[model samples]
Target: MAQVLGGITTSHIPAIGMAMDRHEEDTPYWKPFFDGYPPVRAWLEAQQPDIAVVFYNDHGLEFFLDKKPTFAIGTAPQYHNADEGWGIKPIPPVTGETELSWHLVNQLIDDEFDMTVCQELRVDHGLTVPLSLMWPGNRYQHIKVIPVCINCERHPMPSPKRCYKLGQSIGRGIRSFAGDQKVVVFGTGGLSHQLDGERAGFINKAFDQYCMDTLVGHPEELTRLTNDDLVEKAGAQGVELNMWLAMRGVLSEHVTELHRHYHIPVSNTAAGVLVLENED
Candidate 1:
């Protein structure tokens, strides 16, 4: 049967991708942020999971104000990166496992989580940036991906509890699949920073550290936090941390923290990355 080997959580700040694309990694402004991911890339090279279930939010690239689903799953045979009005990243397209995706869709529906299934979906930096950080040098082409999108841009987004429960359901679904594939789940976006408003340029290192520490064993306590509380404390965009909660819910109760990196001011955001493996 297919097995979920582990999960990764990281910030998906577009500026990080821009730094990489522009070859500015060594520059003083971006070097620290770039330095944080080499260990992640190394860890991924070792684990080499066949598939990645990517959890991220769209930033008006594919879905706009016209129509947006609170939860969406990509079932395409391949997922291409989007322009996002700044041109596409020069990376190979990510392959998809349609059969497994269909199975997950069915299971999620059965579990009472209504998800919009996308036969065609365009991925933006939110999804691809993390892949680049985790699997640099076009290594992303080697593995299949299932894009699980959460609606963090819009209001009335799924609560922390709901995202966590959905992840639990996803874990159950992956275990039920008959294929012998090794999978990794990813929760992308946030470690606290506000991008707009008078309170823009906010960064909450304390809150971000609290989440990184607590999520390992006390995720239930995080579920008690409301989106408003997250926005107030972590920053507006920090609400995206709910995506991390979902990723956490997919792992075994006891996971070993294999790697972690955190940095400040990655373009109005506090960037963070974590790799956790199931305790065998």
Candidate 2:
């Protein structure tokens, strides 16, 4: 069986990647921002796991509201980093671990988790931004990926409890996977920030800090809160926390915080990063 190497939690702010491309990791405006996670960069290199199961919401890039899927898994042989106005980064397509992906897809259905499987899909910043941060500079060269797209941008979204349960199903899926390899799971989203008409600049530092530490220590209570509570306190856009539950779900109550960071600026968003792996 494959052992899970660790988990990564981070925000998917599109601007972060843009900053990196401009070589502004040291610019006063962006230097300290990316530098906040020296430990994260080192941990990623050291672990060098074989596969990463990434959980991120699609920004209507691949799936639109017309046919949004609550949960979709990328089983494609290769996935392209799409160019949504900005030119595509042109990274080599990420090869899918089809063996394990198919295995888990069937099992997730058997377990009663509604999942949509796709053989070909283009992933936008929702998946790529966090990836560029976690595995910068050809990180994809070493690790293959399984993309888990959540429907956060759309209304009538999945419930917090359901997202938590989905994580449970994923943990069970990984445990039941009959393969001998190492893997890392990542849940990417926000701590607290909104992007609506007038509420765009909202930030909830208290809740952001609370959710950061609580994700590894007290996920049950974190999952209990509703979208309204997250919207009102965490800002409406911050409901992206639903994506984080996927990471929290698979983790045991005992896990160490390897690295974390939080910030808010552009488009009225709370940008953050949290990475955790099993202690064992």
Candidate 3:
């Protein structure tokens, strides 16, 4: 049976990707944030997961405001990346695990989760930035990707609990798969930040810290927060933490926190990266 090694959560701000494109990791403003990734890369090198199931929100790439599903899973043979006007150069295409994706799609629907299944997807920075961060220098090409997109940008979005449950179901599905592939999950986007209206450029470091520490073992505490509560505490776009919650949902109840990094004002967002290894 397949084994889930662990999950990783990280901020997917467009600026992070652009900084990498320009090779500016050492620059004063970006160094602190970029420095947090080397340990994660080293861990990945040692573990060498064969597949990455990315839990991220789509930022108008494949799904737009006009037609967005609360949950979507990609089963494409190869996923493409495009410059969504962020001026971030597109990375190399990501290979997909079609067999595993189809298996999970069946498992999710059977488990009562309505998922929009896609055989073609154009991934944006939300999915790619974390990949580039963890597997720099084209190393990501070695692993197949399965994108699990949550609707964090629209109203009627899945609540934190719902997303968490979704992750749990995915975890079960992965464990039941016949293949022996090793998997690592990714939850991308947000610690906290608001980019528009009266609350533009808003960030809550206190809330971000609380989430980082709490999610390690007390994810249920976070599930209690309603979407309204998330917006109030985490900011509008900050609700992207749903991806993080979903990532946590896939993890074991008691897991080791391998590494965590938090920085503020990364292009008006609270940037964070967490690596959690599933308990044996």
**Which residue runs of candidate 1 sit more than 4 Å off their true CA positions?**
87-90
Q: Rate the local accuracy (lDDT) of all candidates.
A: 0.88, 0.78, 0.91
Extract clashing residue pairs from model 3. Answer: none
Give the top-scoring candidate (lDDT): 3
- Tens-digit per-residue lDDT, 109-209, candidate 3: 99999999999999999999998888777568889999999998888789999999999999999999998899999999998999889989888999999
**For residues 124-214, could you state the per-residue lDDT of candidate 2 as single tens digits?**
7878877777767746656778888888877678888888888778777877787877888888877688777777778988888888878
Q: Residue 88 error for model 2, in Å?
A: 7.1
As for lDDT, the candidate ahead, 2 or 3, is 3
Q: Which ten residues in a row have the lowest lDDT in candidate 2?
A: 86-95
Instruction: TM-score each candidate.
Output: 0.97, 0.94, 0.98
Question: What number of clashing residue pairs does each candidate have, in the order they appear?
Answer: 0, 4, 0
Query: What's the lDDT of the predicted structure labeled candidate 2?
Result: 0.78
Question: TM-score of model 1 relative to the true fold?
Answer: 0.97
Residue 179 of model 1, lDDT score: 90
